[model samples]
Target: MVVREDSVETKHEAIELVLARLLRLGSLVAAALLAVGLTAMVVGLTGIAPRLITAGLLVLLGTPVLRVAAAALIFVRERDWYFAFFCAVVLAALATGILLGRAGG
Candidate 1:
């Protein structure tokens, strides 16, 4: 399809779209990481070695923490206050769990 220059939108709109898509992609990746982490943690906990389980839990927790920080950066740049706030809260909760898990271990 042939499009005219005047018929197209400005660079800023395209940039915004790109930023939002990037954020969405990040969110998806984070979600996947969290899921995998949780599964590994569960498997380790139920399996033979206690040390392995603890290590698995720690690694699993790290992925979400990383994801949240990355997402927050994107949200802040995009001026998405709501998303930023949500991710912040989620990160805090995950951190607390990590701390408690370590303490208990």
Candidate 2:
């Protein structure tokens, strides 16, 4: 099975495009949520404002994790074991940190 150089480049480019779009959409949604939350707070809709702000912050924080997961999936699909393994390791570390933080907190 001959994997052409151009095909490899195309795959990488596609991965990058997908990742970029993911990040952009995540950021836009988080920003919109945050803005709306702030506006609601200013308008005295205190009941839901904090929840909205928290949701926005959680989305912002989760974006990078999602990016890593996406990259891992892409690499796995491409049969790029090295990068897929690296992504898995990073995800494991992130999960460990989160668990430890929660336990300590």
Worst 10 residues of 1 by lDDT: 4-13
Q: Which segments of candidate 1 are over 4 A away from where they belong?
A: 1-61
Candidate 1: Cα lDDT at 79: 67
lDDT of each: 0.63, 0.93
lDDT of 1 by residue, 1-105 (tens): 225333334322444565566566655665665566567667764443444445555655555456667777767755668989998998889889889999999
Candidate 2 ranges with C-alpha deviation above 4 Å: 1-3, 11-13
- Residues 21-56 of candidate 2 have per-residue lDDT tens digits of 999999999999999999999999999999999999
Model 2, total clashes: 0
